[model samples]
Target: MAGDDEFDRWISPIEMTLNTLTNKKVRGNSIVDIPEHLKKSNMKAYKPKVVSIGPLHRKSSRELLYMKEIKWQCMLSLLHRLNPTDDQKVVPPKRLKDCGEVILKYDEAVRACYMDPIELDRHELAQIMLVDGCFLLELLLITNDKQLNGEPKSKFPVKVSKREEFLSDLKLLENQIPLFIIDLLYLKLFGQKSEGIPNIINGYALYLFGCSSGRPIISPNRAHLLELTHWFLTSRQIEAKPDQERSAPETVVELTIDPPDHEHMESMDIWLRERDERDKKVSKETTPKLERCAARLQAAGVKIKTFYGKNRSSSKLEKDPVSVMFGCKEKFEQGVLEIQSLCITEETELQWRNFIAWEQTRSAEKTWEQTGTPATEKKFSQYALLFKGLVCCEYDIELLKSAKVLKVHDENKWSNEKVNKFIHDIAEGIQIDASADPKFCEMINDLNSCDKGCCRFIMFKHCCRILLTKARKFCRYLYRLLMRDYCSTPWQTLGVMAAVLLLFLTIAQTVLAAIAL
Candidate 1:
């Protein structure tokens, strides 16, 4: 009976959990805390700097307290903007109460979006969402308005650096409110029938991030700002066609010739088998492994080139950032490796690290059965790995720079070495499986083959050139030595020439005597 009681106690919790899971609303947890392994390497990348937006970092530090007043002011300004004709200068109490109520209504859904549980009560969580959502909306609106008017004005008293930092803080993985909270509040502010809320928010976001407005609007179902930005940056339009239409018809050929006898046929079969073995051996030798750095690739006849859009007028941001191609109709002796131009700046590390963090979080939550490996899904990581492989040293950075593939903003502050280290550090601690991306694997194989085809030739040519240069230097040194030691004056120069001529004459005479004998 005691054993039965123990088993029942253990089973009861599992049964209760199952019931809760089945009965509760289905919501995906999108906002996740950065894993300790990733955070340990670069905590600043994941943590918010200028302001804390959500409950996760509400109490992270006292420094965020100053932003609390700013949030309240932004919420009030947004409220005023909604009801501009109000007689009272101050925001009405009822309007503020309505915003809080709306946030409170979706409190449970908002909490479910985060991976970790919120310790704050319903009212506290609602207040955080209400204020933070308003602050973000107001900031976007202010920035958009300023840019549209062609004026450098500040609605808020924040400095340019602080404002930029605040913008960067909005992209942090942990510092995000649910996107629906913003949508809900925006709906409440403008009447419920206003269907353009998503367009408005997405447009403001695109404008704020300096992305082309022509980019497709992200579906409103995105989890947060970071995910929207991720989609905005990495998404591309792919033409879908039926497999039969896309694939070419297979071709087959049959060659027939009569053999003189069974013995001749056997001999032909033996020769064919030997030829097959030799071809396989040669293929194995021709295809080498991926080179470590871009300099080595350049040396092996791989031309590194930057890919702008198909047209010169198209915005670079309009093109997919992760796309890479290697084109060479002939042997790798002259192949062009094309990659989208990457601009590295001071905020690049912070922005990209958070993007990587979001990708890592999403990949962890989703199952690979739906998609393929994380490599195809986590494209930003693949792009980072591409640059990491290409930029291992200062010379590799210079090679990329000369190719116009990598642009470093403010070269005085961000040097080639800094960019090289930044590329190496961006994708640090992310584990990419061997079979992650098939296209990437194919590119690597092609690069290896190209390297194999021209590496030996490049090395031999380099060696020959070095030998020729050394021979020339030795001759110059000998001439200088003869000039200094024996040809200081005209008499000495004539005497040295006479001596050289006499030696040649003696050798000729000796050769003639031997021939006569």
Candidate 2:
């Protein structure tokens, strides 16, 4: 009887969980782990380093508890910022209670953003979101201080070094809260108006972390921080219509042999079809692995420079080289390749790798939706694919360095070889489909064709010039042999002159003898 009761107790909870599965489906799906294949390269980059933001990394370590206290302080500071008045000072606890009410109102929606189930009570989950969202707002407000309406400092200044680390931490894929939730909190607290100027947090969070300038504008449809950043990096190029595939030019052979007859027509057709299929497979297999590395392209008279245009704004993110590492931009031209200056450090690997992992997952989801096949999926890791194809060897890194386009700000600890290895390793196992960016694909194709054909043309012209110069020298030597006395050695020339004089004298004697007779 006791054994039966124990089994019943276990089975009852299982049945209850099964029954609630339909309601649980609507909760959320914002957070996810790095895909299994991506973790094979470097797992550490996918994990949070200094601080944890959302529920996924909430229990990352015991040491992160202090950051929670900091979050609370941030929440308090946010309350003061929202309701600033000269008449009366607001108590922190009472202000928190009022904020807590607003958080509670949208608690279920906020909870739905996370993919994992939150075991905490509604009040606890709301408090977590409020604290984390406020923490992000406070950080962004400080970073975007120029846009602030001359508000005096209420919170102490974060150290320059600490501030950099904080920004890097916030970019982690797992440490993201939905942008809508942050906007919701902002609306509830600040009431959608910031005097006359726009609030920095609401207006520029996408711009700060995302590469917004030369790309598509931020939309409300963004899922989370990582998604926003992914869109900025690739949205414009990936979403553009795919280009048509042109077949490489082929040679035709003519023969006097008679064409196949009616009896062989069907067999001939089958053979022709098989040959075409085989040719296609071979062509795909033989497609150029790399169009040209930095060094090879430079050797072919191609120039590389830093990209600075009307689009490259001098914002705070652009001013700080460290922040730009999150989303570097570039532009490729015919003979000139211009890239945004990027300085990679030890701290940035995690942010980049996590973004890549999220992109890989999202791309898979999109492919599953569109074509129902993972193999034909388009990647959102477009920049990673470009870099992977660009840096095939050490010379490529050297070229980038000589061009002053690539920078490594690792306290000079990383050597050129080490930097080369790092960039290659980051993109080692990626499967880059050339169809993802048709413009870039065309750029690469044109470069490869030009490198091969253009170099041959230059070489042919050089060989022709050398041949012509040698021919001129040989023709001049032959003319001098016949016309000039000093054309050969002195004795040989004298001997030839003597022979000619003797022949002339003999001829004159013969003529005189004939006259005497």
Candidate 3:
């Protein structure tokens, strides 16, 4: 018995290791609560303002508890849309029971996707999935159906005013259901294949999420709402430029991180000294601080031109409003910077925060070597880098606005200062370890080169203007004194008298000379 006990103890650990390695919970985590550090930046952004879709925020408050009836109504309406006559005669509980049974089969897989364990039992979890999935299907269907028919329908119970807020809430990181659950429910309601009809929930999500710029390849391994949306936004396959055509920007700044070799160290020191001397020679001509860049560029005779996109198709133009707002058009070229006129609204912060959180989650799982792929290009990081690179202050914002690159809706009523605050807020907590994107780096290089290239000429012209303006101001002051209108004090009155006498004597001498001739 003693020998048997020792063997059992030794084998137990191996047995547990085998079990863990073969665990059914090997699926990657999809749904996660916002990390504490990210949440600390903006607690309200992670909170559901209008409605909660998933279990994390579903029963969070009494107010949210009241939304259960609305969810039930959405489910019933979804059934009616699927099969109108039969479902109308059926009671809501009976309909829910039928849907709940279908959800139960996949409940375990769904539960594993969440980062934290759900406290609910099997039946309760199934009910949450059915209700939430139906609500989402119905909401997306309303938007898409209206777009198809070119008119709003009364089939949906949500108010038009609340739609924007609800859509915004759906985007919250904590308030999300797995896409598979939504996809399964969609297939059960609508058949697997339908001629002339779009594919299930994913199609609507792609369209409504403003992914018309390009469609991402949807794989079965998709995680959750936030993950899917990020993929759609950033993972489109763009055609690569040829290697010969993709040379680095023509700028003096070094793009490399390596130290100079010992053989070149002395030459490098000599080059630096020469460069310093050259810069000092032109220091007075190039020393004006950059104020408004566009304004400064204009002063330096650089043209600021507006560039609308190439496509004039009205059909494509009307597709996605958000995609259109992003100005995701051409690459930034020399002498012109194209920017989409995007509005900064109250919901903008919430949307951006969720995007950053999703990116951070994606970034954590990424390895250094794996980042070379198109999938791990870190598009949100690209956005932050672009904003940080272009917008240093209110002056830069004004510069973009002057060039018609950025716009705000009159309804939102955002000022230039407010927009600056909005951009900085979005950029504050996000850390992009990667360097600026190659294209963005090229753009910055061009702008900086132009800045340096024009520095001497702009400063020389600026200094001359300053001296000329001061001289003109002095001449104006002298004319005002001589004219007698400015002669209020004793010194001014005497100066005005002397100036008037001199002018009269000059005029009289001229008249006498003319008579003698």
Candidate 4:
């Protein structure tokens, strides 16, 4: 009976552990730390320089400590904005309490959004979310107001450089709090539900990012600010035709925003499955081969041209910056390869690295069943690979520049050599499934076939020209030797002729003697 009691006590802890493990709910983690391998190449790109937002980097550096005070001030300002009729100049305690309660309610969901377990206690995490979320919302409001009115009315005067740094810091993957927290707090502050929250935030993001022309598609399902920005930058706006625009009612347009999560996921799954099927069909039909460097393509009679859309207007170029097209009026002749122009600036590398890092994280989180490939198909990574294959040397850069397909904002900062290296380095460590992009695969096939068909004739002509030139040079050298040494004068010329005749007779006499023997 003593041994039985001891065994039961020991088994109790094991049973409890098993229950805890089995009962824990699995949640999708949208925000993740940059992997160490990616960080080893460029750590500065991932770390926030101005401010830290979430619990991941709350107090990692003393530099971010100053932002905490600023954040509190932002919180107060936000409360004031929410209740302007209050005569008192101080922050209302009730408003602060309401915000805290809302954040605390959603604390578990917020924690689950992060890939790694956060060490901060529940109350501490809620406080951090409340403060950071308000700070970001207030900053966006102030920036938008300033941009629209051309006057800064906020007490916390954000300088232009400081505002740029804040925007950059907010877009960092680790410096994000979930968007739902901000949305919930915005609703609490307003004391009513409004659909304008996502629009307001997304619009401000576009304005700050210098992309005001983008469509501000409101999606409550977005994970965070960085994901929203990524979607805005990558999304294309399809213009309605004249007849469709006239026939379609305005109510149909509003249906595009804030779709149900399950419907969105189902539609996405169906689209991906269809795309994978098409890719398989295309791959089986013809194997696509990557073209050689840009210079080699040019040598093969492939004309590299800048694509300005079907209308030939530069305005439409921004709609799809990474699009590539290839066509020929005749087979193996008049071949033209068109690539959208890319403008490289000082911030280009930093922005591209961060975007790629986020994509890498998202790809890592997806299941094999969802993607149907080893890596998720990312258009930006495909664009990077296109440039990586195109730019191999300074001459290729010159070719692209002359064709108006590549532009450097500042030549002094981004020289040809630097641009070439940047193009090659940006796509490193990114896994690309070439068959995922059918248009890209088709372009590669056309370029390869054009290169092979035209290069053979071009190479044959080149070799023939070289051989003819060498033969002409040999004839000229023999003529000069004979003129200088033997045919300089009449008597010398006669002596040379007699010597040639004697040599010929000696050879004939030897042949006759050998025949007689």
lDDT of each: 0.64, 0.56, 0.58, 0.65
Candidates 1 and 4: which is better by TM-score?
A: 4
Q: Model 1 segments beyond 4 Å from truth?
A: 1-27, 87-89, 144-157, 192-196, 214-221, 237-291, 313-334, 364-376, 433-436, 455-517
| Top-TM-score structure, candidate number | 4
- Report the lDDT of model 3 for residue 195: 14
lDDT of 2: 0.56
Candidate number of the best lDDT: 4
Residue runs of model 3 more than 4 Å from their true location after superposition? 1-27, 61-66, 87-89, 92-95, 144-154, 191-198, 207-222, 235-307, 312-322, 327-330, 364-377, 411-413, 433-452, 456-517
The window of 10 residues in a row where model 2 has the poorest summed lDDT is 240-249
lDDT of 3: 0.58
Write one digit per residue (lDDT tens) for candidate 2, span 365-391. 222222112221233254555566667
Ranking by lDDT: 4, 1, 3, 2
Which residue runs of candidate 4 sit more than 4 Å off their true CA positions? 1-27, 85-89, 147-152, 155-157, 194-196, 213-216, 237-289, 310-334, 363-377, 452-517
TM-score for each predicted model, relative to the true structure: 0.66, 0.60, 0.61, 0.66
Pairs in steric clash, model 1: none
lDDT of 4 by residue, 217-306 (tens): 453235677776665555542322333211323332111112124544565568669777866765443423455667668767788877
Model 3 TM: 0.61
lDDT for model 1, please: 0.64
